[model samples]
Target: MEALEKSREHVIGLFRVVVGLLFACHGAATLFGVLGGPQGAKPDVAAWPGWWAAVVQLLGGALVLCGLATRAAALLCSGSMAYAYFVEHQPEALFPLQNGGEAAAMFCWSFLLIAALGPGRWTLPSLARLRRRPGTRPITRTSSTSSL
Candidate 1:
């Protein structure tokens, strides 16, 4: 059981890393026009939403990828993707298939899950710092506390 739990944690960590890297890749593609991106269409960087979303993608993706403030970064990324899907893609068609918003929807949900699950044990600068410190001995429940 312990080994299985450990394996699960490791897999979650791998998932986090993979997802973070891929999200960051999207940011890189859009921001720098690299990785076969920009698709011959360049969004106006000085504009309002376009540049703002790109900045969030790049910065948030990087932060999530590095496991720093993973939950917050993932949440922000998720919101950005949600906005992209609704504002840019959803109006084009009713369904994702016709609207071309599959990626956006997927990214939004993925980042939401990441935010919910947190950094999953392998993250650097773990959020554990915000929690109570570990005690030298394992905590055990006592009968006296049962009344509470």
Candidate 2:
């Protein structure tokens, strides 16, 4: 239990990285027609909802992955997914299983969790701060005369 508690931050960091990567990949597929391409026809440039959603996914995921403005990015991502689920999926069916909205629902909840929990230990800004900390100086040697 203690070990699990100690590793919680690392686990959260890993979770954030994975979720961000997956979301980014989804956006890349939709926008650039890569990674197996979009599930359907690619949206026209500056198209409604679809194009804008893709943009948010790409930018927000990148920010969350880097742990820069993670909470805000995650919140945006969550909202987007929630919109996707409700607007695109729920009309077809009341439940995710029936409507094929599992991915959207999952992403929405995952991002919400990330927003609440934070970016954990592996944030880029935190690493930069660590590097710039005042006390972590390099060792130095001084010459001294010795008498026996």
Clashing pairs in 2: none
Worst ten in a row by lDDT for model 1? 127-136
> What does candidate 2's lDDT look like per residue over 18-76, in tens digits?
99999999999999999999888899999989999999988999999999999999999
lDDT of candidate 1 over 48-119, digit per residue (tens): 677667778778887877788889999999999999999999999989999999988998998998899887
Cα lDDT, all candidates: 0.81, 0.95
TM-score between model 2 and native: 0.88
Give the RMSD in angstroms, all C-alphas superposed, for model 2.
7.5
Candidate 2 residue runs with Cα over 4 Å from true position: 133-148
Best-fitting candidate, scored by lDDT: 2
Structural similarity to truth (TM-score) of each candidate? 0.76, 0.88
